[model samples]
Target: MLFSGGKLDNQALLTNQAQKMADVPLMITFDGEWGLSMRLRGTPVFPKTWY
Candidate 1:
């Protein structure tokens, strides 16, 4: 999984990128341990697991 420009808040952009890889079997994945909001801006940040 790739996070362009450090962060990706646009789902459509991700979809568009995935669509571009139609021929290849892509497994789009992300680090959930940190949570999506942790990487995305303008969203409520989830508490860290250690917290």
Candidate 2:
């Protein structure tokens, strides 16, 4: 799996990148474990507890 780690926000850009990765089989993920608001603006942050 591949993680973007909050560096991507543009759909067109992501599409281009996915195309480039098409030759390889992998999964892409983002950092939302904290909250979407932490990575993306204008969204509400949900609280979570980590053990």
Could you say which candidate leads in lDDT?
1
RMSD of each: 3.1, 3.8
Candidate 2 per-residue lDDT, tens place, 1-51, comes to 444344445633775678787987546566677766667655566877789
Compared with the true structure, model 2 gives a TM-score of 0.40
> In model 1, what is the error at residue 39, expressed in angstroms?
1.2
Q: What is the lDDT of every predicted structure here?
A: 0.63, 0.61
Clash pairs for candidate 1 = none
Scored by Cα lDDT, where does model 1 land? 0.63
Estimated TM-score per prediction? 0.48, 0.40
